[model samples]
Target: MLRLRKSILTVLLAVFTLLGCVAGPSLSAEKTALVVSVPMEGVVGVSLENYLDEAFAYAAEEKAALVVIGLDTPGGLVTSMRGMSQKILSASIPVAVWVGPPGARAASAGAFLVMAAHVAAMAPGTNIGAAHPVTASGQDVPDKELSRKITNDLAAQMRSLAEERGRNAEVAASMVLNSVSLTAREAMEIRVIDTVTPDLPSLLKWADGRKVRVGTVDVVLDLKRYEIRTFEMSPRLRALHFISRPDVAYLMLTLGILAIVFEVLTPGGFVMGTAGAVMALIGAYGLRMLPFNWAGIILLVAGIIVLVLDLVVGGIGVLSLFGLASLVVGSLVLFRAPGGELLNVSVGFMAGITLTLGAFFILAAGAVWRSTRNRVTSGQEGMVQGEGVVVEDLAPGGFVSCHGEVWKAVSEGGERISKGTRVRVVRTDGLLLHVRKVEGENLEEKGAGHK
Candidate 1:
C-alpha cells in the first residue's frame, strides 16, 4: 500500500514538471511590443488621419508596452500634422517616434509629431525641426493677422506636447515660430529628443530602462526581450495616400475636364457622359479639399465653355484664341500660395496641360469645319436633270416617282400630262416638282403617246 501511494505521487510530480517545461518561458515572456513605422514619404494630406487610426488600433489590441513610430518625412498639411500630434498625446501606450536610417528628417509637421511622442528618439544622421507653414503653390501666405494667429496656435500646441513629454518646450516652440532645426546629436543635447540611437537594436535597448506613463499609472518598460510587431496601412488608406498626391490630383482634374469635353461633343452617349460627370465631381471634391484659388477655378471653367461655344458657333478662331489665353492664366493661378512641403503643380505642368488642351480643341474645330463644307449627296437639289415616272394623271399637274419616292408634279408649259408618262424635272418648290416633256416629245405628243 505504501509503494502504490509513492508511485502515484511520483507520476503526478513528473507530469507537473513536464507541463511547466512546455509553458513556463512563453507565459513569462511579454507579448505586447508593437512598433508602428509611419514612413510618410509623400505630401501630408487627410490620409494621415487614417494611418494614425490604424496604428492606434493595433496598439490598443496588443496592449502594447510601447508603440514606436519610425518616421521619415518632409512634412505635410498643418491640419493633418496637428491631428496626428493630438492622437499621439492621447494614446494609451507609450509612443516613441524615431527619425531613422541615416539622412532622415522630421521637418515641418514632422517636427510637431516627433515632439509629441512620449519618448522622442533619432537614428544617426537624422534631423528634426523646420516648421514653416506655406500654401500649396510654394508661395508664402501674406495675411499677417491670420499668419500670426496660426503661428501662435501652433506654438502653444507644440509647447504643450513638449512639456507633457518632458522635452524642451522652448526649442519646440521655436521650431514653429523661428523654423529652427537640429541634428540627432544636437537635438539630444538640447533636450528636444530623448536619445540618439544608431539602429533599431540600440533603440529597443535604450527604451528598455525608460519609464513611461499610461493614464494615471507609470509603467517601467521591459522591452529587452519583447517581440516587435509592425502595423501597416490598410488598402483603403493606401489608395487614399496615392490619390492625395498633388500630381495625382492634378492629373485627375485634367482627365475629368477632357472627358467632359468629349462627352459634350458627342451627346446621347449616356455612359460616356455619366463617367465624365462622375470623374469631374470627384476631381472637384479633391480640388476643394486642397488649397486652391476660386478665381482660377472660375476662369478655367469659363475658358472651357468658351472653347466649346466656338465649336457650336463658328467664331473664325477669335474665341478660340481668347479661350486659350484664359486657360493659361487660370492654370497659373489654380493653386494658392505655397511654400511648405505640400505637393504643388508646377507652372511648367500648367503650361503643358493648357497647350495640349488648346491643340486638341483646335484640331477638333478644323475637323468640324471640313465636315460642314461637304457637298450634298441625296436631296431635291441633288436630282436636277434626273429621270422620273408619272404616278397619277393630271391636266398641267400630276404625281411622279423620283428617287424611289413619289412627288407632286406640274407641267412647266401648262400642258396636260397623263399617268405612266415619263418626264424631266425642270424645277422644284417645297415637295412640288415642275416637269417638261421628254426630249423630242412635245406635251401634246406625250399625251397622244400615252393615250
Candidate 2:
C-alpha cells in the first residue's frame, strides 16, 4: 500500500513538472510588452496616410501596449492630415506623437497631428503650431469670405482636438486662428504637450504608467516592460513617399514630358514612351495628394505643346520665348493653390530646370531644322549628283554604272553618249538615271569624287 501511494505521488509529480514546462513559455510571453514605433517624417501626404494605416493595423495585430510616432514634418495636405487624425482617434491602442532628435517641429498640419495624439511630446529645441490655413505658396487666401470660412473651420477643428486630448484648447485654436507657435518647453508649460523627452528611450520611460484614453476605455501604458519594435514603411511605400515631395513630383512631370517627346521624335523602341508613362502616372499620383492649380497645369501643357510646335513648324524663336515664359509662370503657380500653404517650389530649382529644358528644346529644334535642309544620301534621291560611267552608248538611252550598280540611263539633254564616258547623274525616273557628261574631269578624278 505504501509503494502504491509512492508510485501515485511520483506520477503526479512528473505530470506537474511537464505542465509547468509547457506553461512557463506561455506565461513569460504574456509578460512581454510590445511597443511599436512608426517613423513619420516629411510631408503628410498619401505615403504617410498609407504608412500610418498599415502601422495601425500591425500594432493592433501585435497587441502593442503603445504606438509611438516619431514625427518631423513641415506640413502637408489637409485631406491627408484629416485622414491620419481619424485613424489616431479611432485606434484601439494608445498613439503618442513625439517630435524628437532636437530641432524637429510640428508646424502647420503637423500641429494638428500633435493635438490628435493621446500623448504628445517634443524634444528640446523643437517647436509646434502655425496651423493657419493658406495657399500652397504660403500666401493668405485671396477671397475674404472664403478665407474667413476656412479659418473658422480649422479653428474649430483645432479646438476640438485639443479639448479631446485635454490640452489647452483656446491656445490650440489660436494656432489656427492667429498662427501662433511655441517651443517645446513652452508647449509643456501651456499643456500643449505631455512632456519633453530627448530620445525614444527617455520617451518610453516618461510614458510608462501614463493613463490615456483608447477608444471608449481608458488604458494605462506599461512601457517599462516593453520591447521596442520599429515598424518601417515598405520599400514601395518609401519610394512613393520620396517622390511625394512637390519638387520631386514637379521634376518627374518634367522628365516624363521630355521622355515622351523623345519617344515621339525617335519612335521605334517603346522603352522611352513606357518609362515616360510610368513616371507621369507616378507624378500625377503625387500631385493628386496636394492642392494644385488646374490653370497652371493647362498652361504647362500649352507651353510644352508650343515648344513642340516650334520644332515642327520651324518657328524663329518667337514661340520658344513665349513657351518658356508660359512654362516658368505655370511652374510658379503649379502648387500655389488655395490650401497648399505649406508647399513651395524653390525659385532657383525652377529656374535651373526651366533653363535646361529650354536649351534642350532649342538644340533639338536646330538639329531638326538642319536635318531638313541636309542632302539626301540614300535610295532614288542618292542617285542624283552621283558620278557614273556610261557602259552603253545610244542617242537617248544607255546603261550606266553608278555607285557600283548598273542601271538603264538617258542623257539629260537627249544627246548621244559614247561608251566609257564619265557622266554625272541628273535625276532618276523609275529605275532609269538621267546622266550629263562630266566636263574637265577624267575617270580617275570622277571616281575620287564619287561620294
Q: What is the C-alpha RMSD of each candidate to the true structure, in Å?
A: 7.5, 6.8
Once superposed on the true structure, which residue ranges of model 2 sit more than 4 Å away at CA? 1-32, 177-181, 213-219, 261-266, 292-294, 336-351, 370-395, 399-408, 419-433, 441-451
- Model 2 residue 12 lDDT? 100
In model 2, what is the error at residue 22, expressed in angstroms?
A: 26
Model 1 clash pairs are 135-338, 137-338, 138-338, 138-339, 139-338
lDDT of 2: 0.86
In candidate 2, which residue pairs clash?
135-340, 135-341, 136-340, 136-341
lDDT of 1 by residue, 1-451 (tens): 9999999999999999999998888777655455554555555567777788887887788677778878887777676776788788888888888888888888878888898888889988989987755555555457887678777887898899898888899998998788898999999999999999987778889889678876677877877676676677778877777766555666677667767876888687778777767767766766654566777777787888777777877555567788888877777667663323333345566677788878877877777777678764479875567678777775788788888888888988888877666788888887888887665554445677789
The TM-scores, one per candidate, come to: 0.69, 0.78
What overall lDDT goes with each candidate model?
A: 0.76, 0.86
**Superposed Cα deviation of residue 381, candidate 1 (Å):** 10
Native-structure RMSD, model 1: 7.5
